[model samples]
Target: MRPREHASQIPPTRSASIETVLVVTMDHLPGYEIREVLGQVVSSQARTRNVYREGVKSLRGGAYDPAAPENLTRWRTDAVARLGEEARRLGANAVLGMRFEHREVGEMWMEVCAYGTAVVAYRSPAAPAPDQPLVAAETAHPAEPIDSGAIAEAPSAPNLRTAGETPTRPD
Candidate 1:
């Protein structure tokens, strides 16, 4: 009998376009994010922490213990993957100001929330301004704050298109 060829034997083409941006926000997950996306599956499981030498040392009166390193790593990886999946769903290429929040639910239960703003970012045409040295004012007198009315407001995009024309679209 002739040997059967499998689809996995074929390599992906180099011409394939790849998404350059990735945005992620996660809470907690059991399985890997990539696995979930590819396999279209997701699972959640509660994890427990084990006390260790470091955790014990850091605690006062030997009241605290360390958590399992393996479980911690796995949970973190899954959370990150879930966040990335969320960003991908939102059509965001990158995430900014990512932050995590931890909360204790019960005696042994802890919750972790990973969050950030996801956006599609592209390189700007102009270069950023150079850094400048700070200059202290010699006078101790306070300067008057600028009035809001004195500043010019940016023209709205909708108004720009109209340019003095009567409103064609209903409110």
Candidate 2:
């Protein structure tokens, strides 16, 4: 039998659709504040081995191209898309503290679950003018002086080496 054609070797599309839900592993967006909590959302997909493919793989014996499958890339794309759908359904524009879990189902199937807290995050309002002082001039705390004590009160320990010296291990 002829070998199966390889899936396109091009990089997989990594982004979701036009809505562009911000799904991330971090709990907080760096420049945005979470305006509303929309609760948790999740999605999953199952993958099973194809017996015909496995037979071909076994027959090829030691010919496995470790990186050929790119299964994670495919799975991640699917999971993220599904997660984005779920988040949108919950009226959330972003998923925060996102994480994934994987498990082997019985012997032949694998399942991946993606989950996170859904929330609406918006950029916080600009701050008040920088030079405006909040406190009265008389009550401002005074700066304290720094005092560095004298050095070399105790004898210097031995084996301090110069830049060119190789260090020796202690016996």
Candidate with top lDDT is 2
91-126, model 1: which lDDT tens digit per residue? 544445556556656655656555666544443434
After TM-score superposition, what is the CA distance of residue 87 in candidate 1 from its true location, in Å? 0.7
Worst 10 residues of 2 by lDDT: 1-10
Query: Which pairs in model 1 have colliding backbones?
Result: 24-83, 24-84, 25-83, 51-66, 52-66
Candidate 1 off by > 4 Å:
1-20, 23-46, 49-74, 126-171
* Alpha-carbon lDDT of model 1: 0.42
- Each candidate's TM vs. the true structure? 0.39, 0.59
Top candidate (TM-score): 2
lDDT of 1 at 90: 53
Give candidate 2's TM-score.
Answer: 0.59
Candidate 2 structure quality by residue, lDDT tens digits, 1-171: 100111121112346351446788999876667777889999899988666666777899946755436886678678878887787676677788889998989767888889999877666566434575433221232243223442222133344557358566879
